[model samples]
Target: MQGLMQDWPLTVDKILDHAKAWHGGREIVSRSVEGPIVRTTYAEIHERAKRVSNALLGLGILPGDRVATLAWNTGRHIEAWYGIMGMGAVCHTLNPRLFAEQLVYIINHADDRIIITDLTFVPVLASIRDQIPGVKHIIVLSDEAHLDGSLPGALAYETLVENASADISWGGFDENTAAGLCYTSGTTGNPKGVLYSHRSNFLHTLVTMGSDVLGIKATDTVLPVVPMFHANAWGLTFSAPAVGAKLVMPGPKLDGASVHELLETEGVTFSAAVPTVWQMLLTHLRTSKGTLSTLKRVVIGGSAVPEAIVRGFRDEYGVDVTHAWGMTETSPLGTQATPNYAISQMDAEQQLQFKLKQGRAPLGIELKLVDDDDKPLPHDGTTFGRLKVAGPFVVGEYFRAEGGKILDQDGFFDTGDVATLDEHGVMQITDRAKDVIKSGGEWISSIEIENIAAGHPKAELAAVIGVVHPKWDERPLLLVKLKTGEAATKDEFLQFLDGKIAKWWMPDDVVFVDEIPLGATGKIDKKLIRERMKDYVLPPAAGVASGAVALAAPPEPKIYAPEPEPEPVVEPGHEDDAWLHWTPDAAQSVDRSRREAPAAPADHVEAPADAQLPFRGR
Candidate 1:
């Protein structure tokens, strides 16, 4: 027997309808491109989104066509988001930070028919105009005054919407149809697209609204410092409205002072950003000594959250920091930092330790760890293993690539991260599978070393890579970008790592650089470092004690060559025989005086069919 409840599918229209009906008076604030805060209500926004949709239809946009947006987080951007999605046209948010060539490639590849962008990006788009063949209609999200004379045949955003009828009907369509498309950060290669369906987006929003995840509520004011181009801003776009929460969008200025001013003025209760932004905010707060009394909590992710950042927020500012973990394919949020009842009253430091973990899997998302042979790893958090995840929001395949062939046979997506889950079910990331240091027979987590090094007072940023060491197969080389006006002795920094890690995990040497290279997606670029330090030679142990200088050409090791015939693919429940090769380097010796590297014994843990991998450092 079916229940009497309505079986209507959850779509952007439904979310907007609910927001307009129940929370019509709630504020949706944004900083206009001209530099002032404008406050509007959800009811007004609902009407404008409908008008924008009608305008799209007027311009001959059919369902499933890609509509590109190159605007910042503002009222107009939000309208464009819902307008395209509501019409069943996939909204492709283009990152302005990407290179001109990449921008041209993505726009042309997606066959974007209409592009809604701000005036600021006009210059860049103009430079690559002739290259983008798919883009036909360009709508500037500003008035004529802001428009430059060089932009030919572009319609103003207001002019298009003002004449559009607000009564455009949303013809029924399957919720499984595509609604949005977000490209990866392209750290290693050209960016791949993650196509999100309406069903996936709707489910992701419900999970985000849970009390354990973002816990969005109508009374809360959310400011997503993460850009819309980044995994749909961790899927907060829908979560904010699904729960009727007030949203404050900061336009272009994301600096500490500007962001802080917006947070204070808007009375923002919750916000989310990466560690770098929080660090800058913490520094500004320390210098200004101003209190963020209204700010209640901050969700830090995209990168690992330092202990100092967590402690500073809780102890100093009275704001709880939730260290979340997810990826572009996971609808951006897989794990939250909320603790269970048992650990709620634990000591502040102990609770922080628990909070530091990747928390637990959000509702409807499953996490598990697996070995090289596809066997399940335990949740003991001691055994580190590769992380695999699957959920409603998780992408099964890349858009327009290989005809949906990205998933393994078991339907799990490899997150490319190595991690372990503790007894408390909190996931701790060790390193990326490609970056995990293999010394002798053990794996050394470079993230642990980098995190510790970053905690040092003098260190601004740190990256640990397995450089060519003649003795231990591979030894860690520390690359540091020091804080301005801070002085740190190499010996002192080494001493700081003494008790925190194993002696074998100690870096062979510390190299100072003007700046640590960062990828387009804001993560540290270890690939560049490995290339720059390709010819570096390690100092002999005997030379360290004698202060004698002896430089020699680095030994060339045998490179592993793959067989012409590929190995057979193993199904999830099947086992295949494969041999892994390991050899120790002969030139570098482990510094016993240094700290011992911590073992990720949990790397060996595995999960069930729908299990998630306990990986970290995403």
Candidate 2:
């Protein structure tokens, strides 16, 4: 028998309604793209959002219609987001940093009718306006004063909203209605859309607000340096409003000075951004001798958080750095590195070591690792395998079914990340599946070496890629982008990693580049790095010219034949039905050092018969 409960639909509109009702006086400050600091409260934003809905309705936007926004993180962007999502319309966010051709492709693929953009992106949008035939109206997120009449027939956002009525109703439809659409970075091929539902978004916000995850409270001030177009700014858009937290939008000025100015001026307590942004901020702080007194905690993701970044923030600024991990597929919040009980008990060095890992999966998410043949790997913290995740917010299929059958038969989506899950539920990403180096039939994590190299003071950015070697088939080649006015030789860097990693895992040669190529998401573009270094000739020490260097070949990993795929099981009230079962035998006591490359553990603990247990959050 099912327990009776109220049937209140979990729509995105309720979040704003609740915020307006209770925290109406809370400030939502923004550094506008028009060169001014704009301040508005929840009550005012709520009213404006309603007007946005009415304006969209007047513009002929209907339920499930796609309304795109190619604007920065600002007050107007927030209003447009809620207005579109609350009115049963899909808010498709366009990343301005993407290539013009890519933006054109995504806008056309999404079939967005009306696009609301900031003045900064007007030129970019106007150039491709003719290419996107589906786009009916271009609503500039500025007043008539800023309008230079560059694009013909463009409407001003203020005029449209000011003319609309605020009495429009919201949330009469089902909670499962599509609310947002975000395209992937398309690093490999064409980008695929990840259509999010109101249910999934609302649930993700709830889970993020939990103490184990982001733990954003009403008293905290959040600065999302990450763009709203990038996976919903890592879900800060929903979680901040849901908890009545004050939001400080950085707008388009994401430079170290601008971000630091806003953080100091606005008294921001908590922030989330990629590692590159933080690196810039740290550089600015050090050069300017500035202090971050107001900033308390920061969540760093998008790429792995370098050890130097964590130490810089923690030791220098006295700020806690939480290394997070996610992708476009898992509502972009698969795991957060908040200290658990066991990790908190460790000493300072050990704690930093634990914090360096990607941390554990929070509640509402399940994680597992598998081998080449899809066989489950033990959670011994040593055996690295392919990472997979299943959750309510995880995408079962891409938008419009672009990539057919994304999820495995057992309901877990392969993340294309190589990772290791510890016994305490912590997960550490070693390398991307395509980026892992295969040397002498053994795998070497390029990411692991890159992280170590990046920690060096001389290195501004580092990337590791596998280059063909005569004896080992493949060997890691280190690429370094030295900091400004910093100089380092290949021998110096190799000496830094002498005792840090295994001798066999050492890079063959080091090459210095002026700048490292970063993708649209601020991640090191290894694919592009490979292309740039495709014809690069390794030094003689790499054994490319002569097979003089003799290295011992590691034992080949066990290969298992593919097994029959299991069918997905979906049951009512049983969220763990989609989770892979892990028995007690799967637990192994192995002290694995993730920092240094070490030999694989000798003993293996095989998983026993599948005994499913109810999913629990640590």
Best by TM-score: 2
For every candidate in turn, the CA RMSD to the true structure comes to 12.1, 15.0
Measured against the true structure, the TM-scores of the candidates, in listed sequence, are: 0.86, 0.87
Write candidate 1's Cα lDDT for 1-618 as tens digits: 979997787676678778889989998899887787889988988888999999999899999999999877888888888889988999998866555676777888788999998877777777778888678889999877777766787889998888888897763788898999877655556667888988898898888899988897888999987767777778777888888899998876666777789899989999987777777788789889877978998887766677778888888999999888888788778888799877787987888887777788877888889999879999897898998888888989888882357777788888888899877778887887888898877899998898888888777778788877666888887766666665555576688889999998898876655445444344565665565567666656511311111111111110111112233333343232111111121111111111221110011000000001111122
* lDDT per residue (tens digit) for residues 1-618 in model 2: 987998888899999999999999999999888888999998999999999999999999999999999888898999999999999999998866566777889999999999999988788777888899999999999999989988888999999999999998899889899999988777667889989899999998998898888889999999988778877888888899888999999886777888899999999999988777888889999999999979998988877878999999999999999888888787778888777898888899988987888888888899989999999999998898999999999888988789799888799999888989888888888888899998999889898899899999888878899999888889998877677676566777788888988899899987765445565666776776676567766677542321111011111211111122233332344333211111221111121112232122110111000000000000
Candidate 1 segments whose C-alpha is farther than 4 A from its true place: 1-5, 402-404, 542-618
Instruction: Output the worst ten-in-a-row residue range by lDDT, candidate 1.
Output: 601-610
Q: Best lDDT goes to which candidate? A: 2
- RMSD after Cα superposition, model 1: 12.1
TM-score of 1: 0.86
Alpha-carbon lDDT of model 2: 0.79
